[model samples]
Target: MDEVLFRGSRKLEIMQVQAQLVASKTKEVFATYSQATKALISQAIHSNQVEQLKQNIAQLIGYVLEVTRDFKYQVTNILEPRRLWIFFSTVLGGKWSRREVGIACISFVIGGAVGLGVGLIIRRRETIYRYMEAIQISHYLGPEGATVVEDAHAPYECGQHDVLVEVKASSVQIIDAQICCGYGRTFRRILRRIYKQSSSDLPVILGRDCTGVITDLGKSVKRLEIGDEVWVTVPFWSQGTLCQTVLVSEARVARKPKNVGFEGACSIPYAGSLALSALTEANIDFSNAKDKRFLIQDGCTPVGCVLIQLLNNWRARVTTTCYKRALPVAKALGATDIITIDDSHYVRDVHEKDPQEIREGDQKLLLKELEVRGETFDVIVLTRNDCVDLSGFCTKNGRILCTAPEELLSDSCGFFSRLLLTGYVKLKIVIQNTLGLPSDTFDEAHLCHATLDRLTEMVEDGVLQTVVEKVYHPKDIEVALNHVQSPHSIGSTVVTFR
Candidate 1:
């Protein structure tokens, strides 16, 4: 009975071992199937994601191309000049009768002509209006001579060598005031007659120089074009620049200095030209100016200031005489020495002497003072006739020049008188030369386009500066002229158009 029980136990144990082996194989197969199924599902999902990403990239590229095409199309439409032609072709594609086509062409021609005529008329009227509203002097009435005319005749059309400038800003100079008071009337009248101009050319403009835009160009213009900014110096015999527009010879126009505005630039041309001419007359030039000594009388004047600055630029020593009030201006303009004029005692205390004698005495005293100091200059610039006797202050082989030589010739009335006076003046100059008093007269011909261009370079390089003390509008031109004529006026007085 024990053996049989043991056998049954063994059989039961073997069956249990077989059942356990089968269950292990089944679990292994199911796990392998699950892993393969998971890998396939992951690969399928990755492939679908890659395909979707490629489609999205394609769509993005298409969108960029569409934007580019749209931008190009818009630009082409805007830049195309044939758009009107294309529209006309599309609208008038159908055939029409010969009479209808002729009528259409006639209508177009008439419309264009009318439009052109209206535009020309408007332009002409505007130009006329601007010219009529200019600041002009009908007669020599001093500072109050300048008047704004609303019904004056327009200036003549541009000559072959002329350009029309729309004045932006102009300077009211002492010379302008002097001209208003008939300073150069006789000479200018002579010039007009020589040029065969009408004697009835009244209402003369008074500004000598201006900064402006070129509004019109003559057929012969070469160096300048319309809308170019220019600095212009009008001849004394021509119509001046205080007007809204001025007709200037191309020879008198130069590109304005880039460093300055219209107002600042306006202060330069006349003053710079005058100073340069005076220096040239004195035989002083850029090459020999270094370390040279100069003496400028009435240094508070515009020409005097320019002389000081220009000499300073050339590394020269400059001595100036001015009123006490103008001392600072001289110093700022780089004068090496300043002598203040005290005319109070001479004007007030010398009641017994003649006024002219008193003035001469005062000037002599100044010369004596300089002599006492043993001070001499290589060049002496005499701005006023009162100092014409200052030749003694010049060093050996030095020179004296008059900035306003016209004033010396002003006393003569007729052509013969002027001619004889000029001879006398020449004789006087020769006598002075014999006396070792070297002197020369300033010639306006030296103030030309070349001089202006050189000055523009100096100004742009900061070697020269504009000195404007006051600025006024066109309506206040009278005040500006008065200020320029005032004894206390410093630097330049500018009149702006806008």
Candidate 2:
């Protein structure tokens, strides 16, 4: 009986040992999975998969430490700050190279080892929040003129307003502020004052229109919650539109169209919505404007293209001006009547011709010459600030939609009056994208969906093209800006962030 009992006990011990082995093997498998995830995340980051890298970095690192080894201390507490600073300088300083990463790592280890070690010993969490660095424009009524300056961006708190939007990417473009029928410079000055008075605590966010997954929800937010990918636009007063983070009212949030990437969709809202608003302000009624003649100045520009596309959608007659070099591109985007204004002979002939000849093109002459002949159109859309003299030539009682300012406002009263006063020649603002606007003041999401959708469609359908004659990386910002300011350039200038 004693020998039999010993054998049975031995069998039970053996089975217990086997169960332990299985558990150990399972953990090893999990550790391997964690390592794979880390490798993938590193690869994604290197590849500039910004959104995916953001999502996976934290969880993968956490899993690796927990399962691979019995790490008693927090690695992040030791490494996070040091790693973050190095990571940031590397990322924001310029495009990432293997050598740069190596240098950053070496410097971090040499300089921040003690701090990182202490942090690791004290920290329990190993995750860091991802944020994009952005440029904030602060305008002050300058001693010389309206001085626009850039400030370091911070975070924004969403008050009880209702909606919040995460920005994917923001489009940065320059417009002729004097002629553009918007209050960008004026509002910028106001924001500068508020920021100055607030001790520079104000957050700078970008993305006039955004398409992203919703990561959090507010208490009053009934329609959205965690994990809902949404597109949001803030109201005009919110300063969160130009940075990596954005907070908006619920009234401004909307669903993103699934077909487009977030980056591609960013400009849509600002460009598309502005067009809609401009049309609304004009009161020409898109549904009734079929077969009517409309003149769109500066057809080579994005806004001009947007205006042209919308008018064409309504099947209106469209006339546009393009430099001879840009004529092909403009035609490709659907310019029916194109006037090449760079030719001196063309200009002189039109100036000398009979007003009637200028009014109606004889097939040999351009439409601008016809305009000199006192030819009037159903709608005249001015896009370039310097394209035409606003003080002259607009037909009395003819509808005029302008995106740029013809002259600088001498004072606030004149500025406000021009914006408020309505006349025989109606002035309307048409913008498709909104960037660098305060979110606290305007509804951003509604504008994004309403405008961005149309803008994307125009691009995809070949109605709009990014005449990106040049691409300047983030580090080349100064060079790009200077180049753009030069007297002559055939195409539009753009800066891209990598």
Candidate 3:
């Protein structure tokens, strides 16, 4: 009996060793399979084979779900707890002890955990790739002044009255250059503090207008829809349009005219808005402009050209002043009388005069020349700073409109001095209104959706035409900005995404 017991015990020990060997071999096989699978997945992802990776992952998830479903059905319907334990033991050759059973259970748990972790990692990677990355040209205060940043994580969530636009084209204006050089820092800092509650306002984008497709719309937006192409003029104190995308209030956007492309459409918004505001403030509309005489100073400018065309469409007689090189452009825009100026002086006929004399005589000479021809304008639009007081050239009840009011504020003056100057301007306007002076500053026009809508009609009707001097890619943004700062810029400098 002792020898039989010894033989049986030895047989049981050998069976245990064999089971251990089988488990080790199974674990090694699974480990090799997992490593190979991970290698293939990594290669697919790195190679940007997104579709193939997605298909592999999908198949893996489906197989896991089908296996889980079959296991659940068997456990719930065909096996009790005791039978399940027996089934696992039978599957392991029915020679497993309590220790071996525990080991098998642990292996199953670890395998499920590994599978779950892999699925989570793959799902996370897919989630990360789903979002569209944004890029922008941002200005900073330090040595890294302006930079083009990829994956800019600026907040683009739309508000109740806002729209998100995918910018196709934008134009560089004088304001963009000035802001890049730190213009309006103090005022914009105050505004930023109020809005964002942060002290620093350095990293701001610098663009005024753009043409783009609306990618998203706020709940309160009524007239616009996603995918509609539109033109926008961003508010001065807000984030600008020199980026892949921008968020603006619906009130500042209008449908782009069908007659123009993105580059042409972008060139129109800022200048067209200014021209319309100036004309509307001066009470000059299509209804009453027929046969009226108007004069535009520095008529080769973008805003000046827009003004000339709009007035011409109203059947008004347009007199314009420009440098000799810009005369053809001004005339082609429908200026009835083109007064050529020297490159440095406002009057070409006074070019031979002394610097001081030219400064003093150009205005007088031009006015005398106009008077000698019995020419007095019903409206005098000052688009640039001139030594000449064009107020004297308007008819008795004519209006004087200065479109560039910020130029007055740009002079070197203290806060109190500027306040007093502003008061003096108001007093002058009141006096002109009271005494019937020929020159009168128009009230500031509030830019809104209605104004842009009107401008769009004018554009489509062939009344207002876009003048794009040059179109630069975003890669050449610095060149575009520098070009706009040139005093000799004839029209608009546009930057296109494509």
**lDDT agreement with native, every candidate:** 0.78, 0.54, 0.75
> In model 1, which runs have C-alpha deviations exceeding 4 angstroms?
1-130, 193-197, 342-365, 408-443
Q: Estimate the lDDT of model 1.
A: 0.78
Model 1 Cα lDDT, one tens digit per residue, 1-498: 999999999999999999999999999999999999999988987897878998999999999999999999998996785774455556788465557767888999999999999988877554433335578888888778788776655555778888888889989877777777777665566445544454633657878899999988889989889998999886666678887778777888999998799998887899889888777766787788999988888877778878899898888999988767788888999998888777566546656776667667667767766877788888888765556477777889988886753563563477788666546655765686699763333225655688889989989998888988899887888898877754456788888886
Each candidate structure's TM-score, on Cα atoms with residue i matched to residue i, is 0.63, 0.50, 0.60
Which stretches in model 3 have alpha-carbon errors above 4 Å?
A: 1-147, 195-199, 342-374, 405-445
Best-to-worst order by lDDT is 1, 3, 2
Weakest ten-residue segment in model 1 by summed lDDT: 438-447
Question: Which is the leading candidate under lDDT?
Answer: 1
Cα lDDT, model 3, residue 396:
96
TM-score of 1: 0.63
Off by over 4 Å in 2: 1-132, 137-166, 175-213, 222-240, 343-374, 390-397, 405-473, 478-498
Candidate with better lDDT, 2 vs 3 = 3
| Model 3 TM-score, 2 decimals | 0.60
Instruction: Please tell me which model should have the higher lDDT, number 1 or number 3.
Output: 1
Q: Per-residue CA lDDT of candidate 3, range 287-348, in tens?
A: 99999999998787778889999888889999987767777788889998988755655344
- Candidate 3 — what's its lDDT? 0.75
